[model samples]
Target: MNFDFIRRDINAQKAKSQYRQLVCNSAASKGKEIVINGKNYVNFSSNDYLGLNNHLEINKALQEGADKFGVCASSSSLVTGYHYAHQALEDDICQWLNKPKCLLFSSGFSANLALFQALGKSEQSHFYLDKLSHASMIDGAYHSKAIVKRFQHNNIEHLTELLNRSGKYSTGFSNKLVASEGVFSMDGCQAKVVELAQLAKSEQAWLYLDDAHSIGVIGKEGQGSNYFADIDITMATMGKAIGTSGAFLTCSEELYEYLVNFSRHYIYSTAISPAIAWATKKSIELIKKEHWRREKICELSVLFTKLLAENVELVTTESSIHAIIIGDEKKALNVSEQLKKQGIWLTAIRPPTVANNSSRLRVTICASHNDKDIRCLAECINKAIT
Candidate 1:
């Protein structure tokens, strides 16, 4: 029962499996390029889909918020830390998503953890998830102490079968809650949200959509995948789309208030800086005021997919995320290294991040990237593959 020996054994296995995490140093600029281990390269791996990371207006807003609210709230939200900025941002998200209410968390991970832990009852209730849902969701389900079931990714039939089986066992408890990502992070495939929503309705299950990757990049005004589908609760992260830090949940007013009262993650954790909340409010405004960004990103994504298809194996995704499946971990790593050497950088997405045998280079294209940047990326990819 020596835990140190057990930990060492696990670390050894991870090292042997090439599952070690690597660090990359980022440089400041248009935010499209970054420096990794002192090497300068064009970045194709960030989640800043609109290149707002270095936006002047965002910076100005941040300064303004900081000047007005100082650097820290210095307490948890339930302990007098919720500022006007926090309330404002929450309201903004509620309005944007057209929800009756919204609640904020420090990060998307925390938000999911709070939601699943609060809503997913232990044993008496079950949580069903997509196989490809983010680790946050899976970890949250595990933490929820619920009976966890997973259906095959995007396989409505598998989901339906699972739901049908659960229906027979609903005599003693809450049935089940269905959860999924709007966009699969590594593969870039979208959830069959509309279909899943209908299935949830017919099966009498509550639906939770974590639209972290799609919130800022998908839907008409970026209300996220729920706009295209029906969902009882929609979770999003400001860090991804709004170019700020923190997570949000938009749902019915009752559920929102319930979470504020009962969710441990929300009630216990230190609230985000009021300045960040203020900055996020401005970011949302910018995202709504400018509709062209979403359209431009969609166009770039399609263009990147089409061009990459000509030279290498690429997954067809309409979202901002485009992946080149290399299958083997080592080969994916090598391909990523080769691309980086050619001044193009994309992370080698490997097993554990994705399923076994689905390692890939997840290239994220932002609207800030011009056609020439994408063309250059295509050229680099072609050359690297050759």
Candidate 2:
């Protein structure tokens, strides 16, 4: 009786076509193809942008790490969980991003939460986020003690106006922070990193970029936003492009110390898997050297675009994600089902993940996919949508 709202919310979600359920893969998925319900499907819904999900070397490193350092951290980093693997991974990330320090977390969501909660420690802190930032970032900002404002997505002018306006309400000196995703997860659009960095510099605000979808997919060396601009903070997940588990935050030494000392999430939580960290380090190394992988994604993306029907509303994106807007929840799901029948596994992104009536099939064109795969997906999507 006391938890009646839970049932009500579930029913409301079902009625609105916003209820979510997970689909389990029957076999090991290595990026390009997946087996589900004893059938194979071209995996367009995967986030392994660079197509290194099951690299032999990375897998070997994971095994090596498990043999050397065990799988789990066993304790909090401050207590005893900070293994050599984590330290080496952190060091590698710091060098790769050219940051003063790096800290590892269990996942990107928790890392975002920890960063916001640590930096927004007082009311004097003001956080401005892009309207289309990842849900984790929105949650982090809203849950923090700081005053939060949201600017129009990728609108530098709107962000500037908000930054200027924040001064009017602050009682005294304020710690201002601007947060955005380097590459928006759903829409596959990139933030104007250079402009944002400049704006943050002029306003004396820290620019925080969530590169969950960018790292290991963007930049010549896969340094992500750091290659384009000197960001104050960057958070990226190893699970997406690096094809491993856990996440890391790169920041200045001072901010790093502040987070390590004050962040409750960091202080109390157990460190990420040592094996995964080691594997992630190897993945980053591969990402940096494998220019062909990034090029493959670009080539396949262009081919996919060329093949899709003119009537299909696929958004142009430089990133791996290709969002085909269907504008209706049921319609999007129907299209997804059609694609599934044609041996393509594209998921329908519904409301709450996206805006109302903007449900889409988020297609991820990875390096693992070939021209044949692209043709199949495009033709299927084109026929289904048209």
Candidate 3:
């Protein structure tokens, strides 16, 4: 049989305790709670950072958009699929991020791929990425026509050295791009975006930020990296903190025009749902006005940290994500099982998602969670881990 290595690889994964599977959710408010197998769980693995997943205003906007423009784009963007709702959402994102232009995509993964492939015209283009960047980024950069390099995670010195030594290996590379995430997903740590911006400017390189995990969870109005530094290019997803679907990439007028014309991913793919685009705009509006939501998440995050036992090691972050390192895959899974028994839903993040011997419980503290929820979660975690 052809492609028979699939079975062997799967069995090998099972033997290593690295097999993956998905659990069905019976129902969910997707706020502080979710139901599975007819039992409710205090959801800590959710990405609904601002807890706006089921907001009434956004729902209303979605319905209105459906009634007006319908949900589907009905064709590729380059064809007749580009709708008014998509244009409005793009405009809103451009204003929110202070960018000259914006473009929408079905998903952040496709956006990343499109950007890298479009910019990587030839060997004259070089792409430098952070070591801990998302999988989509790695795939995009590697598959592109550009020369690619990875610096140590969050290490400004390493990145600087790589840039300084670029000419030592090759010359005449006109386009140099530096890419990083605003907030890393697994570790919940933030990139040093200010330093990156400065360095990229000095080196005449373009800075690209994937703010998927940071949007609607940072900045005064949740403008993410734009609030801290002026980035050359940026992509943020609506499904996470934005509490909607699809993604948007913001860039200069020149780059936007280039992508629309030259990017295969953007030119061929069907545009995102118009109704979801309308709902995403509403979510962005909510994100700007709802200071209480951000404040609550901060307050609750601090409380959760304080409540944890000293023996428990937590990766501290300014974002909604928190990682509790368990150091072993099976141990991490056991701890997750124990938490589930306590009616707390925590997921075990194992390799190849993370490094070997660094399995963890990736917890997301939402604005919807109260002090009582934090206290109980902390208490249960303390008992289970110990």
Please give the distance, in angstroms, between residue 223's alpha carbon in candidate 1 and its true position after superposition: 1.0
Clashing pairs in 1: none
Task: Between candidates 1 and 2, name the one with more favorable lDDT.
Answer: 2
TM-score of every prediction relative to native: 0.94, 0.98, 0.98
lDDT of 2 by residue, 100-128 (tens): 99999999999999999888878889999
Pairs of residues at least 3 apart in sequence or in different chains that clash in candidate 3: none
Candidate 1, residue 85: how far the Cα is off, in Å = 0.2
Cα displacement (Å) at residue 101, model 3: 0.5
- Better model by TM-score, 1 or 2? 2
Can you tell me which runs of candidate 2 are displaced by over 4 Å? none
Cα lDDT of model 1 by residue, 266-304, tens digit: 899989999998888888888887889899888887777
**In model 1, what is the error at residue 322, expressed in angstroms?**
0.7
Per-candidate Cα RMSD to the true structure, in Å, reads 2.0, 0.9, 1.0
Q: 1-386 in candidate 3: lDDT tens per residue?
A: 89999999999998888899878888857578899889999999999999999999999999999998998999999999999999999889988999999999889999899899888878888899999999989898889889899999999999999988895777575689999999999988999999999999999999999999998888999999899999999999998999989888999999999999999999999989999998988999999999999999899999999999999999979889999999999999999999999999999999999999999999999998999999999999999988
